[model samples]
Structures are given as structure tokens and as C-alpha cells.
Target chain A: MNPTACLLVIGNEILSGRTQDVNVQYIARRLSETGITLSEVRIIPDIRAVIVRTVTEARAAYDNVFTTGGIGPTHDDITSACVAESFGVPWVHHAETFRLLEAHFAPGEFNAARQRMATMPQGAVPIRNSVSVAPGFSMGNVHVMAGVPRIMRAMFEEVLPTLPHGTPVTSRAWHATGLYEGALAAPLEAIQNHYPTIDIGSYPYRLDETQRGVCLLCKGTDAQAVSAAATAVRDMIARLGFEPYEGEPAKS
Target chain B: MNPTACLLVIGNEILSGRTQDVNVQYIARRLSETGITLSEVRIIPDIRAVIVRTVTEARAAYDNVFTTGGIGPTHDDITSACVAESFGVPWVHHAETFRLLEAHFAPGEFNAARQRMATMPQGAVPIRNSVSVAPGFSMGNVHVMAGVPRIMRAMFEEVLPTLPHGTPVTSRAWHATGLYEGALAAPLEAIQNHYPTIDIGSYPYRLDETQRGVCLLCKGTDAQAVSAAATAVRDMIARLGFEPYEGEPAKS
Candidate 1:
């Protein structure tokens, strides 16, 4: 069985519809490459109780739990403290981080607000990133990172090397225009039954008024099985008299 | 208090990083317009126990639970059956949907695979949409929707009228290019504390190498309080050296 992971995107901005999140996709893609099955993702609020309860539960549930957002210097940035509460640890200032951040700012510029960024859960190992001087940290299996896509990616890159990996998932897709999902479903299910290890998916997409099609994808940890199932899908599409094209058809 | 909502995006495509979901933002925006508080969103895989457990929990925890994906004719489309299990209801054929879908298809085309789309949990009301002949359904407070954005939006529109609404949440923003979050945190926190009814948020962004800024926003269900807090934020921005600009600066 593959090692599983979960992502917690903690921010009100995402839930408010003010920000369209790109972090989930970025992390998902990276996790796929690293052979960690990202089984679940939750976009949650910054409420104290919610953060504490969610972090506690998720850390226990998945092999790895990643949290992004709510680690800034602002008042609403309570993730570090909340995570501490979640793990039943003291929220304390890391001496090295404190010294580094204090020096980064001018003598008077490093106020209580800025100091908040340096505080972390006890026993956390700092995740150094190229994007920011301030560090994200890992407490046990839970990795907490910044919300900004650049900083988050950098922190995640640091965390990626430390995670346990499974066999990388492989996929192959065959698409064609004018192929309807209803018409394609039966044959696709038969193919899926033949390869129990493979997951066969039928996705119908319409790019424009004239461009529309069904994309059949075969995905699994077994690379050869995925490729073979995809070949069967292509043959099925050909038998249906629609031209089967390899890979995703368009940007949809 | 506003009626809270939870969105579940159920599909392997999303988890696999193969699809970028647009349904959450659409549903969030629509829910906000209707005065429903969209508090959480979970992207979960199309596993039977996971779907059943998540749907059951979400329906109880929030006033409305909206689910997108897995309502297709394909083998991977297991959401309906899982949802039925979640509610402890018999997965029975919806007569109206069956009749409608059967009529939509040609002779011998409405096979078992296609028939899966017409079946639903007992007591489910069909949610009709203009985009597709196959109907999504609402069982209790859990609204099952299509994964495709167009179809999901259409189904959500139909579900909107049936939900209970609260006061619409309003927002206002003030931004400045040179203002830093650390320097502004104290004043922002004071402003936030002064207006307990409003939520004041400071978001930093970089349009390019040279054009970077912080956007301060005030949001609340109380329109007057939100406006008052926004004016205070605008003043605070102007009090600093940088010229305060109104509204979001760019597409970001």
C-alpha cells in the first residue's frame, strides 16, 4: 500500500472566494512525483478551535500532514501557537530563529508583531526555504508552511525529501472528440474490470462550441498495467470509429 | 448567525493533480451572494468508506453540504452509491430521472452504466440543469453535483433557491505598494480589535519584481460596520507614506 498524505490549507481568504488557491494543485503535483499519495485536502478557517482540533486529528490520520497559511506576523497568524496547542506542547521562541529574525530587522523594527514569526511549537525542526528568511517548521508528521505560493513551494521542497515514498503512480490517457461518456462507459468498465489494479476514468470536456470529447485515463502504481489499460482504451475508442489521441486533449 | 456550508470535491482526478477544480470558488461565491457562510472545503478521493463517512459528518455539522464530482456514468463514479450508504438509505432508482435519461438516449443506448446516473438514494429530489439531461440529486441537506464546472454551476443554481439565506457578507479593500505587513501589523490589529463586528485582513502580493503591495480588507455581514472599518483602513494606509489605492490591484 502507498504511503498517504493530507493537506490542510488554513486561510479565510480561500473560503471567502477572494483568493482562488493554486497551492493545492502545486503540492498535489509535487506529491505525485514524490510517490506520496495525497489522499485528502482540506481548506479550513483560522479559528483557534478549528485549527487545533483539525491539526490534532489529521496528524493522527495520515502518514504526513501539510498545513499552509496562517504563519505570518499578523494577529490572525495563529497557526504556530494553534499547532502547539494541538500537539500539547509549549509555544516558544526558537533561539536561532529569534536571533536571526531580530538581526534581519533593524533594532527598533523587530517588534512583538514581527517576533511572532519566530515563535514555534516545541521540538520542531525548522524547514529552511530560499524564498523567505523566516522558516516553516515540522512537528512530528505535521509540516507547517507559509501561504504564499513561492514560499510554500520552497518549504514543501524541503519537506519532500524527508517523507516516506511509495511506488510512483503512473497514468496514460487517450482522448477523442465526439466521444460521449454514456456511450463509452460500458466498454470502459469492462476494461477496468480486466485490470483490477488500474483505475479507469472517463472525463467529458468541451473546450469550445465545436471542440468536445471524452478522455479515458488509466492510472495506477503498476506502470505496465496502466499503459496496457490505456492501450485497450485507445483500441476501444478506435472500434467506436472515433480517432483516439494520446494525452490530454486541451487545457480543460 | 448565517447558515454554514461545507463543500466536498470528490474525485481521484483532483487528488491526482490531473484536474484543477473551479467548482469550489463558484460555489463559495454563489453561497456568499445568498448569505450562506461557506466555512470549509474538502477534496477527497472517490473511495466508498471515505465518501460515506465524510458526507455523513458534513451533513450533520453544517446547514448545507454541497458535493461535486463522481455523478457520472463511468466506473469511477461511486459518489451516489456512497452517499446513499452515508444516509443509510436504499440506493433505489429515481423514476423521474430514469424516465428522463431513458428518453434522452437512443434505443439500446441506456445500458446499466448509463442507468447508474439515474439511480439515487431513496427520497432524493432530482436537481435539473440546463447543461445536461442527466440530473444531480439532493438527499436531505446533501446536494450532489456534477464534477464539470458548467454542469456543477447549473446544478448549484437550481439548489440555491431551496436553501435558507442570511445577511449577505460585504467587503471593502484598500491597497498600497510600499506598505509592508510587519510594519502595519500593530495598527491593523488595533483596527481589527476596535471593530469586533468586522474582520480586517492584510494580504501581501507581488504583481512583478518592482510592483509589490499589501492589500487591507474589511469584511463582515454588518454592512455599516464593514464600511466604517474599511474607511479606517483606508485612512491608516494614507497615514503611512504610501498612496492608498481602493479595491484589489490586479487579477491576483
Candidate 2:
């Protein structure tokens, strides 16, 4: 099997519901395109003890653990020091990282708070954030990144090429309006049984204030099976007298 | 503190970078609005052992644990069984849940695979899914939900009102575009020193085509202190000759 990976999202703002974690979907979608199955994802508060315990556990368990959030210039941004403590490594000012920040800012612009962003666990290598100079770091199995969606996307894109690839997963979707999931239940199950290797997901959606339907999504490595299952679903929907809308070919 | 909540997103599709986890941000934003601090989030594979262990451990460690994904009818969808096993409870078809399914699906549609969605741990209460009838469930401290973003959001909206609201968390965001993080180091430190209670976050964001800025988001229970710090951030951004964007007023 290809190497597996996990993600740890550390932040109180996330759990408290102040911030929407856009990174997970971004990461999930990106990883899927590259054939890496992100096995698990976790979000935690900005607590040092908890961060240390989580980072250590994930690193030991998974081949690679990607963490987002909690690496900013604020006190709540404590992933760096906690990560260092988890590995029993010293938190040091990364020379190249500091230089990047120095070059980006004017004289005396880099302060202790900003300096906090540069501190990484001893022996960690900076993962280049091509969009912004604030570097994400990788030490052993853990890769720490910014929580901001745009920056996180840039950071992941920078490192994605290096990760291992597995079976490329593909998906197809069929949508039917004006019918509830109950109406499509039998045919959907029949379609799933025919394609044992594929995963058929039924999502009931509402639109335009009145119409309702279940969008049946089939995903698998076998394109033929996915296409067949999707076609079956669309045909079934048509038989029910409702026209089905198959989503444009997009990464699920 | 009211009660701590954590979101566990389980899927191999997320880790290997095949999928981006939007649930973390969704759950985080929802929980923060309700004053429940999300302590941690973990994403794991479809393995039963891992899911069981994590569920048991998290239930013991935190007040509430919300799990998303892996509750569908597919073979990999084993969260319900694992969660039941974790609690040492028998997985049985909940009558009400089955009724909901029956209402939405026909008798032929209610096959073994589709019926799998109705199986819940003994003594579990079904969380309403107005969007779909598969129905999420909760027993003891765990809330098992669907992985799809649309379903997860709907489930959260239904579940949030039932939980106890603790302290109301308030936040303010002040942005400074075109100023690198390195330049505002000292003043940011001074501001942190000035307001110990407010949790200040600096997120560097780059617009699609142009413009780079760090949105300094301050969060806490204290309104005055948060405002003072936010004002300080805006003033500092102005001093640096960078345009700033302040977030709108609190909704609740």
C-alpha cells in the first residue's frame, strides 16, 4: 500500500466556531488529485500540552502528518514550540526563514511576535511558501503549515509533488430534482451492488427554494465502473420521470 | 468553561491529499459561535481499531466529541459499528431512524446496504438531518455525522441548538495589506503585552491576482479589551501606510 497520511488542525478559534477551516477541503481535494489518501484529520485547541501530545501521537502513527493553524505570531499560535517539545528538539531561529522575513520587511520590522513565526523545532527544514515568505517546516514526519486557506493551499501545492502517489481516485455524480431520496432508494442500491468496487454516495439537495433531489456520487479507481454506475443512476432517475443532472467531471 | 468539543474527521481520502477536509473549518466556525471551544480535531482512516480507540479515548478526555464521515452505506463506512463497539453497545436498527428512512425510501430501497444507515448503538438518540434522512446519531459524548460538507453543515445546525451555550466568544478582525509581517513585529508584541486576555491572530492572505495582507483577528470573551487591541491593530496598520479591512459587527 502507498504510505498513508493524517492532518492535525490546531486552533481554539476553529472549535469555538469563530473560524471556518477551509484547509481541510482544500487539502483533501488536492491530496485526492495526487492519489494520496488522507486517512484522518483532527482539530485541536491552542493548548501546548494537547498540541504536544497530538503531534507526537500522529507522527508516530502515520507515515506523514500535515498540521495546519497555530503557527502565527500570536500566543495562540503555539504549534512551533509545542512541536519542538513533542520531539524534544530546541526551538531555534531558522536562518533562511529569518532572512526571508527580513527581506520582505523594512528595517526593524521583524519583532519578537513576528520572530515567533520563524522559530522552528531544531533540525526541521522549512517548506517554502512561494506565495508568502512565512515558511512551513517539515521535521521527521510532521509538516506544520499556516491555517489561512490561501497560504495553506500554496504551501501544500509546494510540497505535494514530493509525496507518494497511489491509485488515482475518480468520481461521477447524477442529480435528480423534485424527488426525495426515498424514491431513488431501490435503484441506487441496485447500482451500488452492480459496482462492488465503487462507492456510491447519495446526497439530497434543495435548490431554487422548492425543488429537492438526491445527488448520487460514485467514486473509485475504476473509471468504467464509476461511469457505469453513474449512467445507471441517471437512467434510473429518468425512468422515474425526472431528468437527472450529472455534475461536470470534477475532482470529488 | 462549559464543555470542550473536538471534531474527528476520519478518511484515508483526506490524508494522502486526495481530499480536502472542509469539516474542520465548518465545525470550528459553528462551535466558536456557540462558545464551545474545540480543543482538538483528528482525521484517521477507515480502520475499525483506530476509530474505536480514538473514539473511546476522546470521549474519556473531552466533554463532547463530534465525528464526521464514514457513516454511509459503503463497506468503508464503518463509523457507526466502530463507535458502537467502542461504547460496548449493540448496534441495532433505531425504530425512529428506520421510520425516517422508510418515509424517504421505498421498501425495496431498504436493503441491507441501505439499512446499514439506520443501525445505531443501543441507547443512541438520532440527530435530525433535515437535509437527508440517513440521520446522524449521538449517544453519551459522541455525535457521528456524514462526511459530505452539505450534510455535515445541516447536521450541525440541527445539533447546535440542543447543546448548552457557555460563554459567548466575541471577535474582531483588522487587516493590513501590502505590509509584510516582519515590519509590524514590535508594535504587535507591544499590543500583545498590553492585552493579555485577548487572543490575537495574524493571518497572511494573498488575493488571487494581486494584493498581500495579514488580517489580524482578535478573539476573546472580553469586549473592551478586544476592541482596544483591534483598534491598536488598525492604527498600527495605518501608521504603516497599509490599507486595513475590519470585519463586520458580531451577529449574535
Candidate 1 structure quality by residue, lDDT tens digits, A54-127: 99989899999999999988878999999999999999999999998999998799988889999999999999
lDDT of each: 0.90, 0.78
Compute DockQ for each candidate against the true complex: 0.77, 0.40
**Predicted chain B of candidate 2, TM-score versus the true chain B:** 0.89
Predicted structure with the largest lDDT when compared to the true one: 1
Task: Show pairs that collide, candidate 1.
Answer: none
> Model 1, chain B: what is the TM-score?
0.98
| Candidate 1, B167-214: lDDT as tens digits | 899999999987789988998899999998887878889878777789
The digit string of per-residue lDDT tens for model 2 on B100-204 reads: 777776657676777888899999998887676788988888998888788888998888888877876788898766765656766776888899888777666
Candidate closest to the true structure, highest TM-score = 1
Docking class of 1: medium
